[model samples]
Target: MASSLLIMQARLASSRLAQKALLPIYAGKPSLLYAMQGVYGVADAHVLACDVASFSSFEPIAQEAGFAIMAGDADDVLARFAHVAKEYKVDYVIRATADNLIVGQELVRLALDGAIDSDADYFCFEATAHGSGVEVIRRTVLLDAYANASSPFEREHVTPYIYGHPQRYKVIKPVVESRFFAPDLRSTLDTPEDYTRLVEFFTHRAFPSQTIIEEYIAWMRSNLYQMSL
Candidate 1:
């Protein structure tokens, strides 16, 4: 079995929502904790990747969650990911973001399995209702992207180089079959409204990320129907 690593990239600094990861989501627990919890047992190892300046701020949180931390260039997120992937000797990597709290184990597993079964260089969900999703890529493919990708967009947003260059890499966007397929629903915490909605979500009794997502979808559909009526 090829070793896979799940890397959650996060930072305290944010132009839209500063320190959003530290925001209390469930009973005073930080949003990062919940994000970390969502992917437990889905990877051989898990690491929280952040910049050096923000390392101290995130170290305690990572420690609390039993996750390792890797600090790298603040703007070069792809470099950070590549470094971690190389250091861990991981054959595959599942990329995630901290503000995306709904990236549950199921989604991670789906991406990983799709990449392995299809022999794809990169794999991701086609249309996710939530901002939560996983990107699975081989370490060699990531290293190649890091080396040849010139655009800041490609470096900062990782995996774009691979997907953008279809001739060089085989990409797969797996369709996620679910009753709750609300692609319009925003699950990422990038704005005040997103934070407020997430707070409301966490206030309810805790459940797995998948269940929370399903419930949210159901609620959204019903609310839309009522509004139309």
Candidate 2:
């Protein structure tokens, strides 16, 4: 069985929503904490990858959330991922973003297990606007891409080199069957509008759980109906 690691890439320098990771989505917990908790048991190891300059700001937050921390190049995300994969000796890696608070653990497990069982170079859930999702990559493939990829976009986005070269890498995108397939719903926290919707959904409810995406969508639909009255 191949060992897998989950790396949540985060920084305080987002252009649209500065420090969005540190903002609270429920109660007083930071959004990073919620994101981390969402994938708590889905991987063998979970680490927060950030730039050295921002390590100080992310350390305490990561510590509080019980996540391992790694610091690397701010711009070269692919290099940072490869470095972490090598350092941890993990054969596979799951890439996650900190702003995605509603990432489903079930979907993450399905993607990772599918990648490992099928020996795929890359695997991802079909991108849906209903909620965030994760991607799985083989460590050796990622390292190769990092060593040879020249474009800044490929380096920054990570895994693009592998998936972009379909002839070279086997990629799998699993379809998730769920009634919560509303691709029109935006569940990721990217802008002030997104944050506002998140706050409204989580305000009086218990800290949003794994079913947050479904719950939020149901609530939005209900609210719309009430307004039509």
Candidate 3:
């Protein structure tokens, strides 16, 4: 069987929070390192760089930091993703954003298996705002969308065309035990506020073992009222 996972889409660009992925988390390592290492247990992982001319100096940093990085358009993310998919030649792709460092490995393996085994073109965690975990997609399905999608929005954001066009392709979502809002627990390194929150929490804890999900769930339980609100 072909490799299940390949690139973890990441970059040092974000309008709200510049360089969010490379921000230091714990153990004096960059947050991308945390994200890279977190998924390494479940499958082979690489970092997909938003290849921008003159503005993407951090590609070397990601490389020096030990993540195999690839380059493609910064704005046309579908093309970027398709480039990596072709480069790696993976059977399936697990679309995990750099921000989603809290993502679990067992969940990734299970969801990937479902996407590959079933006739599903898209196997997602959810179809709404709470859909913040892992996303699994097969190669044939991705190539189909990558080839046919034409709208600016579709090309800009990868897989939305496929997810939105379920009539054209089968989509499956694996079941997981979840009912609470969970409030993201300040996961998925986003804005400056998010970094402040994450840094404050993670700085006190250790690395690898003291992960985003574990830290968030604990803090969420402790600050339930704040989290609930």
What TM-score does candidate 3 get on C-alpha atoms? 0.83
Q: What is the C-alpha lDDT of each candidate?
A: 0.82, 0.81, 0.66
**Error in Å for residue 99 of model 1:** 1.0
Q: Sorted on TM-score, highest at the top, how do the candidates line up?
A: 1, 2, 3
How does each model score on TM-score?
0.93, 0.91, 0.83
* Top TM-score model: 1
lDDT by residue (tens digit), candidate 1, 1-229: 8779989999888888878988888788888888888787788999999999989888998987778999999888999998998888878989989988876777688789889999999998866765767899998899899999999998899878999998889988866776535576777888877888778766764645556567666655665622110
lDDT of 3: 0.66
lDDT-wise, the better of 2 and 3 is 2
Candidate 2 Cα misplacement greater than 4 A, ranges: 224-229
User: How far out, in Å, is residue 52 in model 1?
Assistant: 1.0
Write model 2 residue lDDT over 1-229, tens digit each, in one string.
7888999998888899988988987878888888888787778898999988879988988887778999999999988888888888888899998878776677678778889898899998773544467889988888888888889999999988998998988988766556445555677888888888778877866653666656766887777622110
- Model 3 per-residue lDDT tens digits across residues 88-192: 666787787778766656556667777767856788754212324777778777777889899989987687898897788787765554532354344557777
Show where candidate 3 strays beyond 4 Å: 53-56, 64-66, 127-132, 179-186, 210-215, 225-229
Q: State which candidate, 2 or 3, has the greater TM-score.
A: 2
